[model samples]
Target: MTLTTLKQRSLLGLKDLSKDEIVSLLDRAAHWEAQPVKVNPVLQGKFVANMFFENSTRTRFSFEVAEKRLGTEVLNFSAAVSSVQKGESIYDTVRTLESMGIDAGVIRLKPIGVLADLATRIKVPLINAGDGNNEHPTQALLDIYTMRKQFGELKGLTVAIIGDILHSRVARSNLWALQKLGVNVRFCAPPNMVATELDAAYISIEEALKADVIMMLRVQLERHENGMIKSAEEYREQYGLTVERAKRIAPHAIIMHPAPINRNVEIDDELVEHPQSRIFPQMENGVPVRMAVIERALG
Candidate 1:
């Protein structure tokens, strides 16, 4: 590979990544996934910190596992139990960690523009776990990895992302990267849940089932102000992937969710692990997809 092909220091979002760059990461993930051993010490002496200013279970744990698998020393920082709850700024918490000489940082924050700003200031490479509604690059990466594994190629595949698009960083990151790999992307959501800034097509949930991949996005109720969605039951009625809806999905198609799923809200509980579903597999694929990403940052 050329020098240009071998370089990606940080992953704040996928919006800025080229198709080849994304494929390189995916290809490397395939390499890591095939390894028989549990841990590799390629980054033995490296120190990586996972700093979360927002709440997470899957993303945080996934990154920690990926870091450990690479044999890197990890420092985990959660804002809930940290000084940030004692009136410290987000920058201060990150800067404090940097002062302690961490080699890299995996960050998830609540505000949109803060990560980009932090990227410019932080000397060590900074990987974004999730940055508000802006993007969750790694989640998108693993999602794409799962898709690639299932179908073997991404070009010309149709993907429909359903639920709270207005607050979904997963949708944006997936849209940008998937399109680069030649996937046709669409959004299906309530009017209030739609993001006006994105230029993608909007389709009814019924129409979405015809897609090659139907990705159920988590309804970020906490980010919804003024009771945008009337109720969980109501949202499920209009948009949820009910057991009835799953029957409509093309037999060859796959179901997905960035999960911490609202269960029967955006997707039915029965369908979460259905025969065509890739939900749990998505989480399994995250480790190697992330191992490729973390290795890229520290390599």
Candidate 2:
């Protein structure tokens, strides 16, 4: 129940965490966010690595910033420039880093289950930034933090996650985290994009609009094969959060999207900055949440 209890825990996914542990991390994040600007130096003597096998904007930069802010020395690992490009195995790569005396690692890879496997081999704690379509624990943590900041509690809130469910690590992590906190969750997506293993209610987009939180997922075009979506315009008509559709959402409902938004594709550009949208704040919350994660992993 304390930071000491979280020491050396590898955050592979939200499914591996208890509701109390999740809430404790969020509470620590809030504490960090509320502190005055000063050098806390909580992680000054530690060294952490950011090993990203996939391209990222928010997760990559946020973790780096969080590490720097906490006074931890950061090693940025680029798979493109490393032996991974030459067909080196993940075990070898992680072992190589661990040999360098890295205290902990934040990994984002493109293959599902790789993080879990690598965590077993590495001596240092491995925090999953993302692993294929498997899970993104920190993103879900920041998301819940953002929602809790808005509603002051997570219990009894209904969350409808829309769009590319099959390829969304964010969706997977959020489902586990939210369900544990007593949130009602619904999934709305094109039939092909829905992961049947999720065990959530399949609802119409209109039905989803009625939830307390409407999370729009970015359509992962890179992961989709041909014919997954007929066309962007058609996908928008059926699933995109258009201006008209946005109007019908509950007045108190909050809109959320994990970024690199395709503008008019997943969500209307105008609606992104709307008062009810928590997208930006979600990004802002990433830093403090990650700070808590790194500190806990290495503290």
Candidate 3:
């Protein structure tokens, strides 16, 4: 199908996307990466709204950049500043944005199925930045883009994802995206750190070590009770990736991390500097990958 078919489309998860759609996005991204392309000014007269209910650094800025680069104006709406804090229901808030003729909306929400509910009534395309621990489709797309660039290909590769799987949208998105792209994925966490729903035979960190890539996620201590980590040292002992662990992987295997790493919590400092580490590149690629998503969503 043509990229135009994706027009006014909402990207909420990778599971619903076909391989062709995924490749089309990557192909388009390749063109953007190789050249400086301007957003067709046709959209200059249009508007895109960002409705972020939570605090963010990358997702929020990336959407703004993508929309502006596409020649569209963006209006940022945060809960702290919006009427939602004053008891405005999501139904009323979305209707308000719609009344102003929003061309499209990108939402980072909390309640599960909130987007589904909003989509039923909203007239514009809606992209889900994140919804609780559900999914972060854009983040997953960027992640795959980073991995493809780093390893040159994703198929036939083994990838290990270590850390708090239960609370990580990054991990959930990565698992689905990588698996769909034909990469083997494994998880490693202290028993309780991982989600109960994460059960797969190939899901062991040890088995995935035979992999060509290792992606690490940071622990979400803020989401836990008891205020602080009971013992940071104990948490690391069973799950932290040390220099010695790095030596056991394939020579071609790469290391990755979704940013804001916990240093000694989920990974060793020495492993961060290894030649095989692709964490920095992953972080850097966030801009262009996001640019690609915006271009496709609003192009």
Quote the RMSD, in angstroms, for model 2: 2.4
Candidate 3, residues 204-242, lDDT tens digits: the string is: 656556667778788765644664355667666756677
The alpha-carbon deviation from the true structure for residue 137 of candidate 3, after best TM-score superposition, in angstroms, is 0.5
Clashing pairs in 2: none
Worst 10 residues of 2 by lDDT: 1-10
Indicate which candidate wins on lDDT.
1
Off by over 4 Å in 1: 1-7, 222-225
**Residue 62, candidate 3: how far off, in angstroms?**
2.0
Candidate 2 C-alpha lDDT tens digits along 31-113: 88987984578889899989988888678999998999899999998887898999998778888989999889999999887
- C-alpha lDDT of all candidate models, in order: 0.91, 0.89, 0.74
Per-residue lDDT value at 30 in model 2? 95
Cand. 3 TM to true fold: 0.87
Off by over 4 Å in 2: 1-8, 223-225
* TM-scores vs. true structure, each candidate: 0.96, 0.96, 0.87
Superposition TM-score, candidate 2 onto the true structure: 0.96
Clashing pairs in 1: none
Order candidates by lDDT, high to low: 1, 2, 3
